[model samples]
Target: MKWGENVKKEIGQKIKELRLAKELTLKDLSEKADLSIGFLSQVERGMASLTVASLEKIAQVLEVDLAFFFTLPQKHEANIMRSYGQEVFSVEESKYFYRLASDLEGKSLEPVLIHLLPNQGREEISPYSHQGEEFVYVLEGILTVFMGDEEYKLNPGDSMHIFSSLPHEWANFTKKLVKVLCVRTPGIFQGDKG
Candidate 1:
């Protein structure tokens, strides 16, 4: 195969990975990309090529830059996956304040860096039952995490770990913004990347 063929293969693989990460089905993504399902399948399998315009359209529908569909994963160091710089997961602007720094990507652990705005409180949603465990460490400000009938106030450098099957919720109980580092072992991001 030629060098261009190799590049095309890589791009196709990346597209497949991104699509799966976004939990988009062939039908879902084909409609969003404004392309036929057959065409998308061919492109993903590298049996066909796409124009820059088509690629751009697909990337836009996927809510990612075209360049993002080309980034290669780095070699794992001690089974830990790391992403640096402005990496946003599921880029929804509402529902919560502050920014998230990371997400679980094809790894056994989901590590999220969260930022909580002042006076912002996210009610205890429901206990999520998944085949994994959760660990949380406060980076700054004050946070109160409710687990079942128990609520714990967390300060900077405080950490907690529990089975993810327990019901839990969080709220910022301070004037300053709260930052937390949460790692969910065994990856709970099966398809909720959206």
Candidate 2:
């Protein structure tokens, strides 16, 4: 992330150092984390920025808490995420922009507000699997979810819950922008005091 390149480099170093300490090869980590080896390599070299979800997967395979990588805030406050001034993040050129919505200490769920750009689709990308369960509620426009061979078209106020391990991807085919509230079980993000 251009917003935090130095921090990203430090994190990459930490990941590489720990992976070496545990005597795990890149291939080993890749297979265990279900992440592409090339992407992991790029991350370790600080040449790539990954989403919080991907970072969580790496942390799980490395058997370390997120605190090992991030310097979190010391004080804890109300978990409320205000409407304004939220940092929006995207992976590379991804059309989906996300704002971390929940930052409570010791929380069990991580909720993110996703903004899907207009007329964007996930046709070129293959659905991939990850760990945990996810609940997505469409807040505006239409959100399409492709799960394996099944497809679902969700309108405003509609929601879907499914196992994250199922190969799936979210998309928007309309010309209007789409917004969704996504919450994941067995929470993976530790915003403050990580």
Candidate 3:
């Protein structure tokens, strides 16, 4: 399935489960999620896309982790690493690229191995803050990393580490793909505490 489609379906299912688990009516859950009843209904019906911000808000209201929406139920050892050929999430759309660097189960960190294609670089946007610490190791090409007002240029083998409470963004500065290994500690999802 397409990544977007799969995500949408999973989001719907997760939302439904959370609502049921909380024993909430549609109106009650909508009020808690701070979303319109109709909109939340559509999302639960697999008829809408939940933005990352929206998903986070819903997770907050549900007393769950945002990553809870991404995890697939499974029994596995902790801190496991999959080889290059074993990656479970990799998607290339026209404008961006994404990959999951770690399995979303009993995790203390959320690692995203990303490759930003040239020509898709974004401007210096405001920093976005979350809950923990962030570390990024550049694997290939050049990348511009922004930590609040400071901007650092990172090349292959270089790394940047900062508190997640600080705002940050990145840009691809080379013609080639900019690959980065990003690790966010304390995980972005609530249940990811470890």
Candidate 4:
């Protein structure tokens, strides 16, 4: 799916607004997110797109939900139905596309649809762990889950339940785009410190 420039700009603006509201400078956010100031500046200017992982880091530093970047400021209702045409964002420095499946505030669970690009898997950066549990179902292509020292390969219709505290990561080893439905308890998409 092609991501629109307008959506990228809007998400960037939202992130900038949140940063300003938190009285954080670009350097501060950059340091907190382990990104460079130049990259963060580009992100704020809508000149760059962030991967799901990068956005999660920013949300954590800003103390907001990943959905906050995708959503407009409004009164959130208890129930929400997002259509297929909803915006999808690319991850920073990765070929991943993700859309927030639900944006309800204070929800105990967070669901996301992730499209992992072919031949892309975990980055060389240190693995990250957090306090929660994750459930992933392969919707298309193949997914390789790296949980600490173990690796699990999953095909379409395959699923896995993993403790989020284990330093885990994911990648797509095929030549086609891989799609997965991922849900996390305690909302890993929200203010995660990892």
Which candidate has the highest lDDT of all?
A: 4
Q: Which segments of model 1 are wrong by more than 4 Å?
A: 1-84, 89-106, 122-127, 192-194
TM-score of each: 0.47, 0.67, 0.62, 0.71
Local accuracy of candidate 4 as per-residue lDDT tens digits, 1-194: 44467878988899999999999999899999999999999988989877666777888899877767764333333466446544555544434445464455657777778787676544533456777899999999888888898888999999999888898888776789889998887664455534
Clashes in each model (backbone N, CA, C under 3 Å)?
A: 1, 1, 1, 4
Candidate 1: tens digits of C-alpha lDDT, residues 1-194: 12255556766788888889999998998998788999988878877666444666677777765546543233344544454443442211111222232333555665667675566435423333434588989988888888888878999999999886686666765678788888766543232232
RMSD of each: 12.6, 4.5, 5.0, 4.4
Q: What is the C-alpha lDDT profile of model 3 across 1-194, one tens digit per residue?
A: 23477767777988899889989888998887678999998889877766455676678788887757775434244555445433343222211333354356555667767777675435323345667788999988888888888888998999988887787767775678888888778754434364
Candidate scoring better on lDDT of 1 and 4: 4
Give lDDT: candidate 4, residue 121: 47
Model 1, residue 92: distance off in Å is 6.9
Residue 55 displacement (Å), model 4: 1.4
> Which residue pairs collide in model 1, if any?
127-167
- Tell me how candidate 1 scores on lDDT: 0.62
Candidate 2 at 47: error in angstroms?
2.3
Candidate 2 has its poorest 10 consecutive residues by lDDT at 185-194
Ranking by lDDT: 4, 2, 3, 1
Q: Lowest summed lDDT over 10 consecutive residues: which window, candidate 3?
A: 90-99
Report model 4's TM-score to 2 decimal places: 0.71
Model 1 TM-score, 2 decimals: 0.47
For residue 171, give model 2's deviation from the true position in Å. Answer: 3.0
Candidate 4: list runs displaced more than 4 Å.
72-113, 119-127, 187-194
